[model samples]
Target: MITSIAQAVALFAATNIDDIVVLSLFFARGAKRPHITRTILLGQYLGFFGILTVAAITSYGAVTLLPAGAIPYFGLIPLALGIKAGWDTIRGIDEDEDGAGRSLALPTVAAVTFANGGDNIGVYVPVFVSNSPQVVAVYCGVFLVLVSAMVFLARFIATRPGIGEWLERSERYVFPLVLIVLGIVILAEGHAFGL
Candidate 1:
């Protein structure tokens, strides 16, 4: 359980490294602070839990329909997503942007988060499937707490021009690298590559 919490934190942090920058950008907009903050936080929670719920349901199906030993193969999903994200980053693509003409409403932010979180589901499913139900709950709880912290941290950093600028500039490279490395770790740990 302790290890699960720690792993959950690491996964959440790694997967959300770019979120701080995005949230910072959103905050930099002329919108009211409270409104933007509320939207970001609420959107993050809704998007996160929505992904988790789907992953949990998928986990249930995988656990029942597949052999226990095959569960680790689910790690390949994140590995592939990470590779694609890295490629997109290298190509200067921004899939995280809100859809065309999508206004920055609470629902819009939530939808954007959900859309950008394909890798989240990939990373989440294997973890959720392999763990006991209690551990999954623990991971979800830890993730929710971390999401709040991430919002607060992003808001604080957004208020600082220098730090926010640095994060925005660097995250383009750093975030993809983190995702790739996380994928490698997940694959190696789960033996998803049949190593």
Candidate 2:
């Protein structure tokens, strides 16, 4: 289970790679500003760590407080994130205006980061469902990886050549497809758990 927790954290963080990419794209479109990106990333890290802690605790608490069957019901988490990402990707897949994008405010960045990591909470419920295991360390590992990668991506993209204004034109179709597939998988997992 320790390994699984670690793996889950990795998966959770990796799952957010797209968000980093999208943010990177936005940063590239905007003027390069390490300080701004740092501020945004700080908030982003806080969101990631905060959610992970809550997820670990909630999963542990839920299993003890609720019925065993109710545990899997939490699978809705990653499912939703995947679906949202997929849909958003489809809606904004264009690569235009890569460096002309604006940086988000700290709170907005934090909120977006939280939204991006929303489904990850479900990743924790399973850990507790089986044995009430503690996955905090693994979650922390994932958080570290995510923050590190995000910082690098933001820095790299902010200085890279711009793509002009076209990111939105193409993503419309792509994101929806991602959403549908991710949604189905999550729903399928939910079905299995219910059984």
Candidate 3:
């Protein structure tokens, strides 16, 4: 149980580190509006759970349908997403910025959160498949607790003076780089490329 909790903490932190920037940005923007904070929180939870649900379901399917030897191939998902994010970065494409007049609607925030969490799915699916159902339940519980903590941390950062701005400025560069490194690590660790 302790090992499961530790693994869950590590996995969630690895996959969702980028989310802090995104959430902090939302909180910073919503600071003036105030009413949108609740929407943001709700959307974040909904989107995160959506990612977890997909990961869990895919893990179940993979375990049921694939040979044990093929499980490591799941690492390709993050690798592909990382490469795509890198390519987009090279093209000077910026998807993180809000449009001039866009509203912070619940669906928009949820969609953005879900979209940003593609790598989480990639990492979670394989890990989930390798664990027992009870361990996965423990993981989910840990994740739930951490999600609230994450929101609080982001809110605190966003309310601060300059830290949030710095994070926002650096996020575009850091996010893709982190994803690429994480993908490589996952692939190498899993021996997905026969490394």
Candidate 4:
């Protein structure tokens, strides 16, 4: 159980570190509106639930249909996404520019969260596939707690005047780099390259 908890924490942190910047931006906007913070939180949770649902279902399907030895091939998804993100970065394509000046509604926030989290499904599926059902539940529990911590930290950073701006500006660079590293780590850890 202790090992499961630790694994869950590591997995959640690796997958969701980029979300801090995004949540901070939302919180920054929410600071002005005041009432939208609750909406943002709700939207984040709803979107994350969707991501987890997809991962869980996909992992279960993989476990049922694929041999256990072949499960690590799922790591290819993140590796490919990482390479795409790096390529786009080199081409100076900024996909995060969407939703500028848009109203912060629940649906909008939820949609953005889900879209940003598309890569998370790739990472989660492989890890979840290797874990037992009990361990997966532990992972989910740990993830929920970390999500709350992430929101609180984002709110803190957003409330700080200059920090949010700095993070926003650097997120484009950091995001791709992190994705690339994460993909490599996932692949290496799963020995996907060996297979």
* Model 1: pairs clashing at backbone N, Cα or C within 3 Å: none
**Model 3, span 1-195: residue lDDT tens:** 888889889988998887787677666545555466688888888988887887788898843344444545554544565576567768876543553321356765575566566667778878888889899899989998888888888888877768767655665565456555655655665586687
User: Residue 27 deviation, candidate 3, in Å?
Assistant: 1.1
Candidate 3 lDDT score at position 159: 71
Candidate 1 residues 55-118, lDDT tens each? 7887888434444455455445445555765687678674335433212456544654554565
Return whichever of 1 and 3 wins on lDDT.
3
Q: Cα RMSD (Å) per model?
A: 7.7, 7.4, 6.5, 7.2
Order by TM-score, highest first = 3, 4, 1, 2
lDDT of 2 by residue, 110-188 (tens): 5545545545656555644554244555555656776767667755754544432233333344334443454455446
| Candidate 1: Cα lDDT at 6 | 90
TM-score of 4: 0.63
Each model's C-alpha lDDT? 0.66, 0.53, 0.69, 0.68
Shift in Å, residue 43, candidate 3: 0.6
- The candidate scoring highest on lDDT is 3
lDDT of 4 by residue, 1-195 (tens): 999999889888888887786677666544445466688788888888877887798898843433444445544544565576567758876434452422356765565556555567778888888989988999999988888888888788876768767655665565456545645655565576683
Q: Candidate 1: minimum summed lDDT over ten consecutive residues — where?
A: 95-104
Q: Model 3 scores what on Cα lDDT?
A: 0.69
